[model samples]
Target chain A: MKLSDIFKKKNSGDVAKDRLKMVLVSDRSSCSPEIMDRIKNDIIEVLSKYAEIDQDGLDIKITEMETDDKGTKSVPALYANIPIRNMHHTAK
Target chain B: MGEVIVITSGKGGVGKTTTTANVGTGLSMLNKKVVLVDTDIGLRNLDVVLGLENRIVYNLVDIVEGNCKLKQAMIKNKDNDNLYLIAAAQQRDKTSVTPEQMKKLTQELKAEFDYVIIDCPAGIEQGFKNAIAGADRAIIVTTPEVSAVRDADRIIGLLEADEMKQTQLVVNRLRPDMVKRGDMMSADDVVDVLRVDLLGIVPDDEDVVVATNRGEPLVGDSKSLAGQAYMNVCRRITGEQVPFLDLEAKKGLFGTIASVFKKK
Candidate 1:
C-alpha cells in the first residue's frame, strides 16, 4: 500500500513474469539455454581458427521469421551474428 | 449453428473439466442450448464432474464409428434443460478418434446447439489436437504456479500455430491472500506473462471442491463468487462485455494496510 514498499520489493508477480519470459523465449525458439550455450561455444571455436573473433560480442538466438506462410512456422530458424573486429594476419 | 469452443489447459489438474461443467451450465442458465463434449478419451472425467456419468450409454467413439447416432450419444443434463454432454469413451485412448471425426462431430453438434464446449485433455498430444480441431474459439485455463503458466504459454503458441485465432485465458484458483503476501502471481501478472486476452479469473475457493464432489456446478449457486465468475464468463461468451471480477478488491486496500500495521 505504501510507495516505499513498491521500490524495494520484487514481488512474486515480478519474479513470475521474469521467469516466464526466460522460459517462454526458450520454448518459442525451440532452443534450450543449454543448447544455445553449446552452439555459442562451437561457433566461437570454429571462428577462433580463422580470426581473433569477438567472443564477447557473439550473439546466437532462434526466433520466428516471417515467411509468406500462414502459421508461426513450427521450426523457427536460428539467427547468429558474431561481430568480427579484425582477422589475424599470420604467414599470409 | 453454434460456436464450438474448446476448454483446454496444456497441463492437467488445473480445473479444465470443472471450468467446462460450470461454463456450459452457466451458458445454459442464460437460456443457451449448450453441449459439452469430453474428448479426453480414456481419462474421462467431465461426465463424472457433471454428474452425468450413469446416463452415458454411447460415447464420442461410438458416434464417430457409426455405432451410435450423434443425437443418441448426447446425454442431456438433469440440472439444466438446455445443457447436454457427450461423454468420451473410457475404453479408448486419444488415438481412437481422429481430428476429422472430431471436426465432423462438432459440426453436427453446432447445427443443433447454440454452443459446443469441448473439454480437452492435458498435454499437446493427439487428444489435444482432436479437441481443438473444430473449435472456433479457445479458453486456456491455468493456475498461478510457474509450471502451469509455462504450459499455458506453450498451449497459446500451439493454438496460434494451429491458426485457432480467438484464444483467451482463464486463470483459476487464484489466492488473493497469497498475492497480497507476494507469494503468488496476480491475474495481471499472468496476463502479461502469457500474452493472451483475459477470459476470466476464478478466486481460490474451497467451495469449488465441495461443488465438484456434489456434482453440482457452482455457476448455479448465486452465493458462490467462483460461480459468479463463471456466469460472467458465460455472458462474455454470448458477446456481452462483462467486466472481470475484482478478486483483489474483495480484500481491499484497507485490509492490506491493517495487516501491514499488525506486524508491529
Candidate 2:
C-alpha cells in the first residue's frame, strides 16, 4: 500500500516461477543440498591442486538449459563458476 | 481393444478422482463404452463420485480373488448405459492387488470397453504401481501450486522410467483472474515447467464441488466451464483436435473493460 512499494513489488506469479525453476532443478537431478555440497567440495579439491581457486566465490548448480534453436527442447545441465586467482607452474 | 489410460497425480487432493469420473463419463457420452476402474483400493471414491456407491455388490478384490465374476463387480452408472465403474474394495489396502492382477483385469476390461480409465491413488507407492501397470497412456493432473507441480514432475519422471512415454498433462483448478493479476501460475506456466504436452486446463470452478457432492460429473452439465474443459480433455484423449477454452473472454464485464484498456 506504500507509494515506494507500488513500483518495486514483484508479481507473485513471477516469484513462484523463479522458485519453481530453482526447486525443480534439484528435484529433477535427485540431488540434495548435502549431495550438492559434497560435489562442490570434491570439485574444489580437484581444481585446487593445479590452480588457486576462490572457495567463497565458487558457484555450482544443476539447471535446465535450452538444447535447440527454437528453445523447444531443454535438458538438465550442470553449471560451475570456478574463479581462479592463479595457476601452478609445476604439474602435481 | 480399448486404451487403458491412468489418471494420476503423485500429490493428493489435486482432483485425480474427479478427472477420472468426468473423463470416463464424457467418453461414454461420446458413445464410447467406458469403464472407470478405481485402483485406489482402501480409499475407494470413484463410486461415490459417480453416484454408484449404493449399487456395489462386488468389488475389485472380489473379482481378483475369485469371489465374484467381473460382470458382477462392475456397477452401471445411473446416467449412462455405456459408462460403468469397477469400485475398489474399501476394507482392503492397496497391497491386496498386485501389478500382475491389475494388468490382467485391465486387459479383460479393454476387450469389453472402448476406454478403460483407471483412477490412480496419490503418492509413488504400491497403489500407484498397480494403477499404471496396465495403462497404455497416462494423464498427470496437477494444480497451479508449487507442491502439486513438483509432485507432477516426479510422476512424469517415474512414468518415463517405466517406459509409459505416451503421457499428457492436465493443469486443473486454474484461476484466470488470479493469473491476470499476476497472482497465480497459468496453465502455460505449468506446462512450461513440467515440459509435457498440455491436454487441457480446468479453471477453478465452484460448480466442480457442487457436481462432486451430487455424484454427477460436470462434464454433462454443459453450463459449467470446468465441465467443458473436462469434455475437451476427453476429446483430446481420443485424438480429436479441440481448441482450449478462452477463460479470459468468459470473465464478464471486468474483462471487457480490461480488453478496452489494452486496445488503447
DockQ of each: 0.52, 0.72
- Winner by TM-score: 2
What is candidate 1's CA lDDT for residue B88? 94
Tens-place lDDT digits, model 1, residues B1-264: 889999999999999999999999999999999999999999999987888878989999999899988889989899578998999999989999999988888898899899999999999999999999999999999999899999998999899889996999999999887898887888888997776889899988878999989888889576777988989988998999988877778767757798899998
Instruction: Give each model a TM-score.
Output: 0.83, 0.87
What is the i-RMS of every prediction? 1.5, 0.5
User: Going through the candidates in order, what is the number of backbone clashes in each?
Assistant: 0, 0
CAPRI verdict (incorrect, acceptable, medium, high) for model 1: medium
Two-chain DockQ for model 1: 0.52
Q: Best by DockQ, which number?
A: 2
The 0-to-1 C-alpha lDDT of every candidate, in the order given, reads: 0.88, 0.92
Candidate number of the best lDDT: 2
lDDT of 1: 0.88
